[model samples]
Each structure stands twice: as structure tokens, then as C-alpha cells.
Target: MIIARLRSIGKWIVQKQLAEVVVGLFVIVASLFIFPGADLGNLGLQMVGFLVLVVIRLYPGFSVVLPLFASGLWYTGMADHTLLSGVLAYIAIEFAVARGCIIIAVILAIEWLVFGYVVSRDFNPQVEDLPGVLFEFLCFGGAFIIGQLR
Candidate 1:
């Protein structure tokens, strides 16, 4: 059953569910494109976003910059006709950046599983369970900078 598979995956997934994650990213990115006003191109943005976050995780210095770049890209694609749409675009980008951090974690976890299966390495680690609320920090901190309107 799909439910059984999900539980097994979750036991090892550590972060977000792999299937939900892929679907979530698709929904979010598709929304960005299909919502019309944003005009974001349809192709590789989601995968690129995932990789960008992975690189940022490994290199903390890029954490903010990568999100900022993604936000700028989505923002640039905006074709909204009013101030409300402008504000929404900014907030939406924030959501994208925040949610994006989690998606990258999902991809890494999946890759870890595949590589471990192939190489006979046990990739089990409680690194995920040991986590604090750093994502909250990333989201709020990113939001605050935008609040300053710079």
C-alpha cells in the first residue's frame, strides 16, 4: 500500500516526506507559472531551487543569498497590476525560499538512501531529529529584511 511505503520512507526520511515533497514543489512551482502574473518560466526552476538550497546548507554563507536570488527571480517575473499583487509577490517569494529549504533536505535524504543502498552504507543519523528551529530563524529573518523595504 502507498501508506505502508510512506511509513517506511518516513522512518528513514528524517525530514519531509519524499512523495509529498516532490508533489509540493510541483504545486508551488506550477502555481508560480500558472498563476499568470508571475510569468516565471516553466522548466527547471524547481530542481534548481532544490540544489541551491543543498549548496547553501553545506555552505551556510550562501543561505541567504541563494534565497534572495530565487526571490528576485520570481519577483522579476511578476506582472501584477496593483500594489497588492506586488506585496503578494514578495511574501510568496518568502514562502518559496522558506519551503525551499525543506525541499532540499528531502532531495538530500533521498539521495542518501539511494547511495547508501548501492554502496552498502548505513546512512542513518539523528542529525535531523537533533535539529532546532533554525528554519523559523531563516524564514523570519528573511521576512524582516524585506520589511525594511530594501
Candidate 2:
């Protein structure tokens, strides 16, 4: 019975084209091992974000609110230790674009910028930080373009 249930779940994932969501969830769990010193509090928040991402992927109607929730998580310093929050924001952005809601995408992008600024405010940010920051922006831009292409 359990095996049958697992197979049904697997079938549902394939039917829904939810491989990306599964991968995202895997990465979230992997981060716990990758970063041994990660705060449990932040991990909890990331888990919440991951679950929301899954929900949004399954039901795009939830897309509008995820960016706001992710922004709040970032603003409160609950998502600062990892890139999962950015992934959540980008996924929300992609969903908004898919639905032809450019306004939501723009709002998400602006919120992302605010999150970035808030997270980076404490640091002096030496020259070495430039590459990482640029890469981060590139990822955001790539997400937008990918959504447009789809």
C-alpha cells in the first residue's frame, strides 16, 4: 500500500512538471549538510519558503503573495543565511510573468532589491564582494528572461 501511494505521488510530480520544485526542495535539505553552522531559526524559515514554493508551483494563484512573504522573511533576517530566499523570489517572479502579470513581477523584483540592500547593509563590502553581487543580479535577470521566453 505504501509503495503504491509513493508511486502515485511520483506520477503526480511527473504529470505536474514539478521536477524543479523537487530539486529546490532537495537543495534546501542539502544546505543543512553543506553549511553545518546554519542557524536552525533561519533553516525553519527556509523550510517554510520551500513549502510555499511548492504550493505556488502547484497552484500559480498563490504566486502573488509569496514575494511579499519572502520579503518579510528577508527583512526580518530570517532568510539571510542562504540563497533559498532568492530562489523563492525568482520563482515567484517567474510565475507572475507566466501569468502575464508584469506588475507582480516588478513588485517582486523591487522587493528583492530591498532584501538585498537590507542584507548587505552591515558589510563594508570589499572588492571581492562585487563578483558575488554581480552573479546574484545575473541570476535574477536570467530568471526574468527565462520567464519571458516561456
Candidate 1 lDDT over residue span 1-150, tens digit each: 999998778765534334334544555555655555533332233433454434443553453344344334344553222112222222333333444544433333333233223222233434563332244345445644543332
Best by lDDT: 2
CA shift of 127, model 1, Å: 41
CA lDDT, every model vs. true structure: 0.39, 0.64
Total residue pair clashes for candidate 1: 0
**Highest-scoring model, TM-score:** 2
lDDT of 1 at 30: 59
What are the clashing pairs of model 2? none
In angstroms, how far off is 94's CA in candidate 2? 2.6
Q: How do the residues 62-140 of candidate 2 rate in per-residue lDDT, one tens digit apiece?
A: 5556555655665576666654666766765665565566776676677566555544354344666667678768877
